[model samples]
Target chain A: MSEKLATAPRGKVSLFGVLRSESIRFFSLNSTRILILLAIVLYAAIAAIGTWGIGSLRASMGGMEQMPGMEDLAAPGFASELMGSGLVFSQLILGVLGVLLFSGEFTTGSAVSTFLASPQRLRVLAAKTILITVVTAGVQIVSSLLAFAISKPIADNYQMDLDFGSDAFQRVLWYGALAVAMAALIGLALGMMLRNSAGGITSLAALFFVLPIILSILTSITDWAQHIAKFTPDQLGMALATPSSVVTDLESWQQLLGVAGWIVLPLALGAVLLAKRDIK
Target chain B: MIQAQQLTKKYGGKTVVDNASFTVQQGMVTGFLGPNGAGKSTTMRMIVGLAAPTSGEVLVNGRDFKKSRHPLTEVGTLLEAKSVHKSLTPLAHLRAMAATAGLPVSRVHEVLEVTGLSSVQRKKVGGFSLGMGQRLGIATALLGDPQVLILDEPVNGLDPEGVAWVRNLARQQAAEGKTVFISSHLMSEMAQTADHLIVIGRGRIMADAPISEFIDNGLDQTIVRSADIEVLMNALNGDGVQLRRIDEHGVEVTGPDSVTIGRRALEYGVVLSELRPLQRTLEDAYMELTRDAVEYHSSNVAETGGGK
Candidate 1:
């Protein structure tokens, strides 16, 4: 016990240092890998089944343009847009991953060790924000690509067009990742603010699952509700990737800015609370 | 050196630690002794900036610890043994901490081996026993090879052998000139491990002195035994002196210093066989100072008295 430590001396704490710590700690847990795998597989499986069902239905309809409920299935870009039909589930799964990324430290009492190691509270938050952003964005992109790869052949078998290079396909692939990342960032913010896993996940569900339906009902009653709904985390993510879903004409850049606002506001608020509150 | 200048912490409307101030110097183990809920853990938390003090400040080596570039190297703190995620293995936990301080993985294994946790380093911490958790916590405190070590209740769940190891580790670190501050409610543990003792009761500093000075600071009592005990007792008695005859051959004397009583014994020439200064154990001194500080006393004291 009295022997000198043989390891090399360490330098000061930096952003990269904290990031390296968060990455190692994040990956070492089995739950992180399991969540990422489930998100990808669940997204691709849903996309494939939905594409097959729609393709088979369109094939059986001897067609004379007589179908009323299948109007969305007839759109030129419907295949690409349908590839992200499971984005909501991905958002739920990856968003919980983001929540665990921050809330785990508080829940397990490890905030004491983490804050002691770094001492700067806001720096820890900044590192976690970057970590979840990169991870969720990367995971969502892979899940989208996989979903498209699996769903395209089924649509092609039914004489339906599923082009990868279309403008709508590119939007769903790229902006869909951005939207998933937005949901994840919101979850991260909720986790930091609440500092409890159950509370953070429940509130995240309220935001993505409950609030969207509430707003959709209100939009039917008032035009002002539609304006506010467009900027919500769910709507911003959706409209940015699938522009055909919106009734209002929103420029691509404006949708991007809306996504940016949803991501920034919650994180900024969470950071302020993190810096102010004491670590128990 | 570590200093807390009027460090005050209040939670809601309750004051947990009230204007506590002390300086812990380097090159010795300074024991922080207090009763349960006496603000020892709160004070330790403030030192490392884990719990923000409502007012005043705590400094490490003359600067705000939170501003230090090398925080882990400056201070290795173990505020609680359970400061870890339940699902994480000890190896993963220490690796993360080492990475934050830019320390290599080799250092993590070194501390684990030293703390006797290498065999179980990869095991999940959730299933660790109380003593094993403490060893892992100590392993983390040793990870940075820090200059200042602040541990709160480090030996709470250790066996006798593990207890001895902690004592040796504390002394060994202090021998290297690092500032070692350890807190515990057990006086016997502190008595054996600490060189200087700073006692607190009810969030107030009750005593601060060297270990020797603390024991000697209590009422001066001497034991004198002789064939002619009555003659020695008469010579030892004086204003403010209380004498109790313990046996036919011995008497207990208090109020005067041992030197004065020795001189009087020599002057009387009562053929004294033994004139010994009664050295107070740290337990005795601590119990005397904190008699009013035992929180959650039994409602019926007589029923529980001497039951243990």
Candidate 2:
């Protein structure tokens, strides 16, 4: 019996090992695969639809910018911006993925096995952070690339400029990934702090969608509302990813800082709470 | 080995585990016996660093488990059944856990085979029965082959065969010089499995001793039945011995073994019909020890039934 004990070589816990563990479980779930595929397919489909809509509109209004408030859609670079038309949905969808990644541990009581295997609470957090970051960012990048591939031919049919080398399209491809990754990280943090899937995803939705409308209403009434509204996660993500669609005069660095704040603050607070509170 | 020094835990204003202090030595099966809501689970959680101590400390193998370099190899724990995600199959769950500690994939299969879960390794845990979930939990605990094993209510949902298997597993692990700590509310189960018993009640350590000492702590009670009961009572009555008439021809003698009483009856020329000594069962002793410490007291059904 003694010899049968530990027939395999015993190994220690490491950051890389935990990362591997996180990825193994992450990919094994049906929900994760559904969300990733949904994010990519939905993003590309929306982008193609947007491109066709803009192309037909431009063709119908031949030789003249006759429509008021439609000038942005008629612009040459708008086709590139069309590729990122599904950025908001990507954020929410992948954001829910992030929320489930951490919240599932608590909801299913798997945190017991996870932490027992690697007792340092912060290490588990780090591994989860790394996993969500790579997966969400990678998914967003792929989605953006697929959206571009699907939208480019539609733009060419309308003779619109859909240059892959264009600065606006580049921003949509790269910063768009950053924006989705930010939303996903925030979702991960909310999941850790709330420890409930419904509450975390609802809070994430309220942050990304509902809060902006409420803040817009408040901005009409007060000067301070304008300041806070611009820093909302949804607006910051849009302003960084597709600057042509939103009107914002803030410096690029300030918007990046805002994005950084969204990513870092909640996760840091979650780490502190995770270390201080018991795994109940 | 695990050493808990003045370990205490409180939730809100209610104290859960209050001032528990004990040591679980290697090469023995230590039974943490307590009634429901007696802080047995909380203490086990604390031992593995799942729950932080409110004021005191618990050391696993001479240091905090949180700081251990190889956590899986240091302490493998089963906090409760069904701790794995429902959507995950046992194979995926075990693989994920093994990946965390860099253990070989073969170890996962070994545990699955050991726990008789090979047949359903690919099935989602959500579809597993309670007993199967328990087996998976045990399999997870044994995955790391840790020096210390902490199982909380390991036999809660097991069949009789599984229960005996767990008993043998605990004994074999202890025999192999590994520290085995198991928590159960059943004294009868512990009587058959544990060499050392640590009884807890209402978050307090009630008794910690060898299994033999726990059973032998009570005074001897012997039943003596005779045709000449009055003669036996008068002759057997002495200091430190109390006699009670149980029936028309029987007297219960306390503080003397049946052998002593039989000799005394012979000396007094008493014709005895019965000279039986009642054995103190672990269940009775446990009930006696935790009479005041039980969290919930059930009302007498006879009294309650009258109202119904």
Candidate 3:
């Protein structure tokens, strides 16, 4: 046994190796697979339903020019906007996935194994970040494509334009993926910070859902609140993916900066805490 | 070899591991013996860089383990049973761990076979019994075929056969010049497997020595009972010999073996009904050393007999 151990080939830990490790474990669990499937199905279903709703609304109104206070909904890009109508739900689901990716390690005591193997805590965090990013972005892009595939026929029935080559549709497809990836990364940061699955998920929900409602209420009374509301994760996502659906005065660069903030700040704080605190 | 220099860890205001300094040598199984909450797990965590020490530092193979590039190959640690995701199978967990070190997938299969976890490798860890979980933990630690092995409470829930297997594994690893450091509260287990023993209690190092020296440090104690115990005591009285009266006819003899006492008794023609040697077990020595250091002493158990 000793001789066998001595002769066995040993390997070193590299960033690429840890990333592979994260992916291996990430793909092995039933939760990950279920979450991804649920996100895709729910996202596509919402988008398809949205396309039918808009098409039926426009058909009943006689024509796009007949709609009076809903000009944004009658725009040529509205059909594409329907493809990302479920972006919020997709964000929540994939964000929860991100939270679990990190929180599960601590909640299940697997951080002991992970950290012991790699030692450098930041490397593990970086690997998880990359894994979740690729995964959420990939899942979001697939969901958007599936939504488009199902919604195109519904839009055609109502003579609504759902052209795949339109700039607005491309934005919804690509930026929608970016929006979901952003939420997932935020969830990842919360997971690393809280180290509890429930707490991380709750925090992610509050950031995406509750906080936006609260900010909207505060925006009515306060000028600062209005400015902050434009930078809220929900608004930032909508502004980037379907800008016509959510009116905002900020330029594209400014909206992109806001998205970067949502992605970077929480992760930076989480990485700091993860590196400084004990794993137990 | 692992060296800890004044390693200390404090949780909030309470010091869990207080300034402990000890070295675990290679080529021998070193046992870390302590009661529950004695900071054995915390110390092991600190050694592998899981838990950061409040003060001081620990080095594995002469460098900080936190900075180790080839961590798995340098030191393999099993801090707790089931340090794994419940949703994962043993095969998945091992493969993931092995991937971190770029180790071959075959090594994962090898460790599973060695730990006797091949049959349940595909089973989810959530349903595993405590013993099975422990086996999985051991399998993970051996995944790297590491040069240094640190296992805490390795036999907490193992069967007799499993326990024996771990004992043999530790010995075999040490024989191959690998550093084997195991922590346990079971003194009997340590007595059989460890060549060197480091005893800790209440977060303090109580004793560090060889297994032989640990049991042999105390003087020889023998309990002699006879109607003519007075004659035996008188005959055995000499340099390094101390005799204490247990009863009117019984005397506890110290500093001489039973054979010597028998010889002296024969010379004195003493009629002795009992000449029993009181052997100092590892348990007794450990209890003696950590008498005042037990964190949560069992009031009923400690108060009843001799107050262990």
Candidate 4:
């Protein structure tokens, strides 16, 4: 019985091995595949319906509205931007996928197996980070492309040009993926920090869904509330992905810096906590 | 070989494993014996780097095990719980663990078969019985074919057959010159499985020695009831012998086997009404060793049947 395995030379735990292990476990779960499918289908369906509804409205009215606070709704980029109408919801679902990636390890007591195999706590964190980043970025990119493909014909029915080469359109396509990716990384960080699935996902929603509303309410009474609102994850995602959605004075570098801050800070903090705490 | 040098662990001013130092020799089964909350689990966790030591270190094969270059090959540890995501099947879980150390899929199958988990390898662990989960945990520990195996409370929820299977497996592994260190609160289980014993209590090492020596240190006691108790007591008195008189007619004699006591009584021509030797079980020795080290000792029952 021992001779069969005794002769096989063993290897030290490598980064590729860790990554492959994470991928295999990640893909085999029913929840992960279901969430990914939900994100893609939800994003595409919302974009298609948004394009059809908006085109029908424009056709019946024979023109677009010209009123106060209607400028964003009537912008030239709005046709291409229709593809990203459901991005916030998609980011929420994909962020949930991200949260589950790390949180599942603790909630199910599998972190013991994972850490005992590698022993270096930081390496496990590194592997999860890479896995979450790669898979979420890949998922977001596909979701965006699927939404765009489904929305294009509807945009053409209204004689509105949703050109792929337009700067605004290209920004919507690429930066929308970036927005979803950032949300996912933040969710991953929260999962590691909180180490509980329901708490992590709820906190994620509170940040993206609830905090944005709270900040908007705060903006009505205080001048500085708007300043803080501009930096919230939702604002950063929307402001970057759909550049014409909200008026802002910050340059592109500052926007990128804000996005980088949202991604790096929580993950860095989570890594430190993970290294110090017991696996249980 | 596994060595812990003054290993200490403190959780918020409460020490869990207090200055424990012991060596688990290769090619033998070393049983970690202790009562509940005696730091047996904590010490095992520290050995595998799952729980950090507040001071000192643990070395596996004469090297620091925390930053081991080849952890899977050096030591395979099943610290506590199922140690697996419940949603995953045993096959997928083992396959993933094997991938971490670059072991072959055939090796995964081998461990599954070794642990008798191949029949239910594809079933989700969430619905697994506790015994099946334990089998999977054992299979995981054997995935890398590690030199050192650490299993904590392996027989907690197993049938008699499963229990005997684990006993045989530990013996088989040790016979093959591998280190098999298992922790259990069951003294009878440890007595049957371990060649060496490291008894711990209240986060401290109560005793560390060979199993035979541990049991022998307690000695056998014989209850001798005789009408001529004074003459028997005088004959049994010696440098190592201890005698305790219970009533006017009974005396407990220790430090010598019962056969010697009976022969001395025969030679002295003392009439014996009763002569019964109390064989010292490992359970008795363990209780004697950790009598003061028990962290939680219940008082006498205040009522029967919950005062119903």
Candidate 5:
């Protein structure tokens, strides 16, 4: 028994060890795997469906040629460009997954075990943040590539030009991943703040779904509200991922700044709270 | 060993654990006996650094647990049963915890076997019974094979077998010169398991001594029975001996052992019907110590106030 005990290493809880433990626990759950798979499948499926529908519409409008902006809409192989069409839905799904990662710990009373293993509370939080960000980013990228592959032939059938190397496509890939990452971080923050699954997810939904709709309505009535709506996470993520042909007054840098702000503010607040509050 | 120096915890303006101090030495199973709301859990949490003390400090192995780098190897705590994710199997949870201390995965299986959780190692903890959950909790605590073990209500939901297993485990761990600090509201269980007893009541230390000392501190009493009970009562009457009539045939006497009572009765030529020494149990000692310290006084108004 003493020799068996001698094999157990003592002292100094390393961040790397904590991160590994957190990652294993995060992935071992069925819910986490299901959420990631659902996000990926939904992202790819929505992209393929959107491509087929848009391809048909473009073909039909080509013969008429009377609709305003018809020529602008007739980009060759627009179907391929639709590969990232489901970025919003993907972000929402993975965002909820992110919320559950931390919030579930508290809801199920696992936070005690987690913190006890690594008493440096911030190290555990950091481990969780890195694990979720990496996993979410990986899922988003894989879904985008799969959607592109499936949508390419359909775009070719409609004679739409789909250039993977184009600046717009690259922006869609990079900014799209960033958008999902931001949503996940925000979800992680909300999880730490609320520390309840239903409460955190509900609050996340209100931020992404209800708040944007209310802001859109308010923007229509008041000119000043438009600026506020532009800064919303949903709007920043959408503008960054899918640049519309219709130009707006804000520069590309300003839209990127909006995305950066959305990611930074909430995450900073959440980190502070995570460090300060007692693990329940 | 665990040492707490003037440990205090305040929630808002209410002081849950006052400036209390005690030391738990190694090589002994120290029982933390306290009534509910006596701050036993809070003090334990503070010692493990889960709850920060408002002032003062608790040191495990001569240093604060918060400052210790390898806490799991220093102190193993089973704060509560099922403090794990329901979705995770006991194997995954234990493996993850072991990974933190750089312990091999084999330790996980070893602890599972020891705790009798090998059969349910793959089952989700959400579906586990209370006894199984307690076993899992103990397994996780033993994963690090730490020197000090702190368990709170470890046998709350165990069957007779589990209770016996825990008793043997505690004694075995202490026999190995490891510190075993266990808290339980069950006096009978503590009486059987603990070598040294620390009794807490209403957020204050009531008695901190050996189990034998605790039993000895309470008053000694003897029960006597006689057909001529009135005569025996009269014979036993003295400045030192006090007697209470339990019924028509029996008298409960305090301040005199049964030998003294029997000798007195025999000298008086009174026929001895029954003379027995009534040994005070640990429960009696605990109740006598904590009777005034019970925090929540539920009114028995429904029973006592009803009209006969």
Candidate 6:
């Protein structure tokens, strides 16, 4: 039993304070550390193996100089780019990390603590959004850089040019990181909306994995399916990362709008549900 | 002080709490007594703005809680047990909550110690026993040293010692002039801890008065046996008085104190063999109030009633 005291000063909730709290909770978990480690290790390992396999193939094809388009296949720094071949897996892993960031609150009944501490529920949502975005972006960038540094020499051994400053290379680095951020944001939104780990993760997998394959098959049958497929987050993110390979039908502004829709719609819906529903 | 006016909450066509209204005063532990599903938790949630009232409003310190900027400092609540993350230790959870109000981390440790959670402060809440979880919940409620304290089922999982501890804590808080509001199903606990009682049944207030007044307002009966039972029964009848014959030499008198019955019997020249006033426990009072309101009333009510 404690005595009643004078009312405490209720200052406006600063985003920085909320972010700090999110960071503390995020780093406190063993799962977060494990996910980040797995993302980096898996990315580097996939890159190394792809580089070795591609290098051996090029060596074997060296004597067939007359093969049309074979030289393009041996393009310089291909092996270096191969090092980041596991970006898709990285996205999935880190995206789930984002999903767990919010879903775990509900699953573990910690949303009560979170919302009670900052009753402006949307502020907590915004804070978590910012945290997942920054952390996912940071991890993606660092994982890509590590993979590139390790695979550069392997590409050079095969006499491939590995320029770090090329526009294509930078696109793969920066936009690839952005793609990871997008995936994480989408995952976070789904997590908040679903508020269950399996439901959120399954929905994310369907969006990124199953739906894209289904759309690819659908495109073979109809023109309208191709138009819809071009706007999917999977296509948009892939086009944004590998500019030379995945040519998107969307203009720059259209792609930006698609990304915005992907991020904003689910998050807005999740926030509304969170504000309206009971914490239990 | 906490004032709830016409507070109502409806979920999908069912009204959980129906226009409940009551004012809880300071310097006393007011017990919120209700049968299961009587909307005690809903009322507590509405007070803190956790669950919105469909109609009406609840005010803390003369203002709506939602509009109050300094809510945590104004009112501390333990709404439910284990409303914490499983992965988070009590230390991290409390520190995070304390940081919201810019309160010192030192206060977190202080509350942990106060709630007897110092030993388990570093343990993850997932590993905590129910009693430990309750302690952590209480520690969180006490973090802000609030003017108004609202606890729903504070002693639900406590052992006997923990129960006594909660009783002391409630009394000590009230002695310091804070408005302490606690809800529980345990009538004996409420009887020992609450100075004022507000009994609710079926989302409505059944009785609101001092603990003693609730006990005294209902009924008082005494059983008397004498060689001249017929004489005793005649002597005890008047305004606000009634009598019922028990057997050959026994009678039960209602609406008269034991002293008055004994004095009357002596004045009427009846030698009483046995005279005793049946004490009414708080459990009896609660049962009388919630007899119709209990969701599952036992068939033995008649048998229990006859014995009492």
Best by DockQ: 3
Candidate 4, B219: how far from true, in Å? Answer: 3.8
Could you give candidate 3's per-residue lDDT for residues A34-133 as a string of tens digits? 9999999999999899878877877776756655777776688988988988999999999999999999999999998999889999999999999999
lDDT of each: 0.87, 0.92, 0.91, 0.87, 0.84, 0.82
Clashes of each: 0, 0, 0, 0, 7, 0
Report the poorest 10 consecutive residues by lDDT, candidate 5 chain A: A1-10
Pick out the ten consecutive residues of candidate 4 chain A with the lowest summed lDDT: A1-10
Number of the predicted model whose TM-score against the real structure is largest: 2
Rank order (by DockQ, best first): 3, 1, 2, 4, 5, 6
Positional deviation of residue B109's Cα in model 4 after best superposition, in angstroms: 0.8
Candidate with better lDDT, 5 vs 6: 5
Name model 4 segments beyond 4 Å from true: A1-8, A65-75, B224-251, B265-275, B302-308
B1-308 per-residue lDDT for model 5 (tens digits)? 99998899889998888887999999999999998889899999999888888888999999888777887888899988989999999989998898777777887888888888888889999998888889898888887888899999999889988888888889988988999999998899899999999998877888889899977865678888888888878988888888999988999999978888888888877777788887888898898899998888776879777656
Better of 4 and 5 by DockQ: 4
Error of 6 at A24 (Å): 1.6
How large is the interface RMSD of candidate 4? 2.3
Q: Candidate 4: which docking quality band?
A: medium
Regions of model 5 farther than 4 Å from truth: A1-7, A63-66, A75-80, A245-249, B225-239, B243-252, B261-271, B298-308
lDDT of 5 by residue, A44-85 (tens): 889878878877886876653357656555554244457767
Evaluated against the true chain A, what TM-score does chain A of model 3 have? 0.96
Please give the DockQ score of every candidate, comma-separated: 0.65, 0.64, 0.69, 0.60, 0.46, 0.42
Candidate 6 achieves a global lDDT of 0.82
- Alpha carbon lDDT at A58, candidate 4: 77
List, residue by residue over B103-172, the lDDT tens digit for candidate 1: 9888888898888888898899999998898888888888888889999999988998888888888998
Model 1 interface RMSD over true interface Cα atoms: 1.8
lDDT digits (tens) for residues B1-308 of candidate 2: 99999999999999999999999999999999999999999999999888999989999889999999888888878888899999999999999999998999999999998999998999999999889999999999999888999999999889998999999999999998999999999999999999999999999999999999987989999999999999989887889999999999998899989999899888989989999999999999999999999999888989789674
Which residue pairs show backbone clashes in model 3? none
